[model samples]
Target: MTDAPAPKHYAPRWNSDPRPDPPAVGGERETLSAVLDWHRATFELKCAGLPPDRLSEKAVPPSALSLHGLARHLAGVERWWFRIQFADEDVPMLYYSDEDPDQDFDRLDGDVDEAFAVWRAECDRSRQITTAAASLDETGVRKRTGEPISLRRIMVDMIAEYARHNGHADLLRERIDGSIGV
Candidate 1:
């Protein structure tokens, strides 16, 4: 009996490129909000219509980077910057443990629905914390490091971080499937 050849693997494709024209903004919202919104939308676009396995699949063997892992990392980062840093609350970091400081990106055998739900919940919480700032100039000192940080700075940092990771996710997703942008 002849053995069939292995199925060819296809890369991912994105519909809307990140280099597209920026969204139009009017009064009230600052540049920070616009940046955050762009990153958030990009993240959602990268995650749309992906199955749990694809979302959670590791791009590299034994590497802690995956679409789901990126989502989880962002969730933890949002909590740290907004809740702990901005709100000055003593809350435990999500998915963090002594054994793994970077549990956010660690390989986990979790369902896709659970990951999506967690990501959505965290995104909502992040928006709430960001929107509550009295102004872009509002400052909050980090409890752990005592470094003074402004809401504007935090939001900008978040946007930058998310943008970078989303780029990685885009490439990874493409490698996983022929699916592309939103």
Candidate 2:
């Protein structure tokens, strides 16, 4: 008798349960936080439970856009906006060194856990900074560019940036396997 092929093992989808609708907030500050939360959650959902090879897969030639890279890039994004811009701290950028600025997405020689750990650390830092701020009206200066900006704008920009990257992640994940959705 011929042996049957084993069924493929698909990674479990991240947080498939739908979130309860956000409660009404008193003002724009609360609303902005809620939006940011949603974006963050969505991004996390895309990367959850992916294996190392899958996370670091270079499906597209000449492009280093892997799940690990995305996570690393997002960590850099948080460090730039929250740590440098908002906290007024002088922190060196991660994943981007002498080699290439695009190294954030470039596949490096590390286990999947390392990349995810870095990503989670940055995400937690971002949440702490955002949560501590009194309001979106808080003003801050960009460290590198020396441009005047406000927390409100940063919050909005973060959401937009994350949303765009999340779209890319969705397609990448789908290509890796067949799983989809939050």
Candidate 3:
């Protein structure tokens, strides 16, 4: 089969996505995959075009939920689920050390561009793994647990992850600026 066209990267922002829309009535795999992609894009939109310091700010008092933290966590989440969990690729943690378990959310010291780049690479690799899988039922072993996981479950979990985190992102963005909705 011929290769799919190279994806174009347009820096995303609230209500300004260059990505394609998902089908309203596609097959199970198509629909699920498309929804996953949409949620991922939503996460990006919520964090786009913010200043580094703004991104790093923990908007909610006593809750370490910054847009920067969300980006870092989501990057690790993508790598955890797709690379370590789904593709079974040997990889190291994106953040978080034994002493700093909340590094992704707590220690926001890295450059924003570097964090975004890591997240983008993970997203691209995730799409590749999903595309190459034979079906949603395709199984991969979980790294830490040594248990089996299905692509279907991973997709659903990822959607939930984005949904939950995007909520935090929305609040963070609103706090950063008065803007809301995407």
Task: Give the top-scoring candidate (TM-score).
Answer: 3
Model 3, TM vs. native? 0.87
Stretches off by above 4 angstroms in model 2 are 1-15, 18-26
Arrange candidates by lDDT, descending: 3, 2, 1
Q: Model 3: per-residue lDDT, tens digit, 104-144?
A: 99888869889988999999999999999999999998877
- Cα lDDT of model 1 overall? 0.75
Better of 1 and 3 by TM-score: 3
Whole-model Cα lDDT of every candidate shown, in order: 0.75, 0.79, 0.86
Q: Looking at candidate 1, what is the lDDT of residue 153? A: 81
RMSD to the hidden true structure, all candidates? 10.7, 9.9, 8.4
Q: Report how far residue 43 has shifted in candidate 2, in Å.
A: 1.6
Ranked candidates, highest TM-score first: 3, 2, 1
Model 3 regions lying over 4 Å from their true place: 1-19
TM-score for model 2? 0.82
Determine the backbone clash count of candidate 2.
0
lDDT, candidate 2, residue 64?
68
Residue 50 of model 1, lDDT score: 77
